[model samples]
Target: MPDPLGPLSTGILAEAERRWDLLTAADPSLRRAVDLQRGLIGRSVQLFETIRTTGVRAWPFNLDVGRLRSKLERGVPLLRDESWTLPVGPLTDALLDFCRMLEVSGAGASAAHISQAIDSKRLDAGSLLNASLARADCDIRDGAIQLGLAPDLLWLTAELAVSPYAYFLQRSLAASLPPDVLSTWDRGDCPFCGSWPALAERLVDRRVLRCSLCAAAWPAHSGCIYCHEHGDAFSSAAIDRARPERLLETCGACGGYLKALVSDRPLDFPLAAVEDLATGDLDAAAAARGFRRPALRKLLSAQTPRPS
Candidate 1:
């Protein structure tokens, strides 16, 4: 037997498949995007662990600024200089491959358009890199709009190409932040990348924030750390009480739902990404309950957030 689901990630994949079927049953458009993302999660984990670790890393702290406001405020972002350039050619090729994988899933037409665009040299690695970084600098949802991506294939083309670079970037930035500096950055967003966390892990008694883009992990305060909307306004998800390790925290004040994974041990970022996709039921349930990201976002807090 080939172990149909495999020993590793069998449970996560199974749950994700169930969630995918349920989510797409109501909104068919999510099917291809979800499937494509599922495929890339494994690749992303591998890439993050394999990228050049030594030469491409730096601490982004700035003394003149006093406190970190934005990631770009202090250091040069990847792809801006010759020393920090990404493997743009490989990234573009990967996106095309992911798009092709969507062909059998009734997204053949979308795949064809993306393929044609790439074949005609209408898209190049440098242009794609420029668009992805620019998009990350702004709102994530607005990436499709700002990048002028095709309407139907947001996940397959633009996001896929950008994902590898995001993983590589995460590893580089994660290495730079020291424990003391990380502890002082008591904010919902990553101190290193300034991007929102994809998930938070409870490492024994301490909880750490993991960046969605750069994969940087740092400690944080519990109870709606995202919007600072605690008390009666916040609530843990009612689903799967047996699995308390994973939770979807919804804050009524900001209507922002953050995915939280309470664990006794550290978890891998790549594996966490897989689990992030698997938690679509939580996302859908939150959406059905009118939970959403805050319209006017406030990702960071004042320099002092504790009893100091």
Candidate 2:
């Protein structure tokens, strides 16, 4: 499948390969993770075309700067207003393809189990996709348990499949919104998808949060992103004193940690994962210190209604 974004996807994949080579060379243990990520990036590029040409429907947005401000003030993400109904045909195709890719990427028996379940009609791909979009964690967990699959693995695969669609919707929604609306978003979570930032990019003196899901970028708070704790509880340390540009920011109050890197600019969409992978050392450092990244924030809007 040719990449829909053509030259853009080509550049992104090339950059990803460059980074992966450096990361794996520095730490050979990252080989498996790098392989998985490489496959995912390639598949996502293909799916980007699939999503665009299939005419998927994005959730409608008001696009009023005032309404956007109100939503941001209340900690509601921009797309949280209405349930997004993804086209089942494209979504199902993406999910099945990802499942097969996972198998080829050495996901082991769990991947096979999911594939078998879907193939045998024991699992409904559309239902699983909708549940994931709705943030219906319990349903997903139950379905996984019933199918004798690892819940986390199943959820991760579903999330991976849904991500390209989310990316497409977010880009569309973002383009329609006023340019300055994102500036008013102060929450730790992504103003677009409510996912915690994969990492922070420090450009000059300001920190910008990069979304793990849709790869959206937004300004970050001065303090701890999880709890708004800016006191002494919020502190950072460089993993390598010689390289202060790469550091881990930890919030003692919430026991939450975020990896930050000084960069010339925000990372391109989807490439944020590459940065996150390259900084695995920071994640290890934070874990060694007993700090951790927080779970995905379930938006209040996720509970509104199921997608049609």
Tell me the number of clashing residue pairs for each predicted model.
Answer: 1, 0
Give a tens-digit lDDT track for model 2, residues 1-308.
44333334566767778989988998899899898888887887778778776656433556677877888888787766555566777767777778887888777778888878877878888778766665556678877887788798888888777777777877777766677888777888888777788898999878899988777888998889999998999997798999898989999999999998899866866788889888888898899999988766765553533211
In terms of TM-score, how similar is model 2 to the real structure? Answer: 0.88
Cα lDDT of candidate 2 equals 0.78
Instruction: For residues 1-308, write the lDDT of model 1, one tens digit per residue.
Output: 33211123456446545656775786787677677766766555344333433333443323323333233343323222223455565666666766676665667776766666566765454555544443333333343354454543743355555655665555543443343544445667655545567777877778787766555676777678776766999887646788676788888787788778876655444555655766677778779888875432233322211100
The models' CA-based lDDT, in order, is 0.56, 0.78
- Give the clashing residue pairs of candidate 2, or none: none
Model 1 residue 274 CA deviation in Å:
1.3
- Best by the TM-score measure: 2
Once fitted onto the true fold, the runs of candidate 2 whose alpha carbons sit more than 4 angstroms away are 1-9, 57-59, 301-308
Looking at model 1, the pairs that clash are 170-214
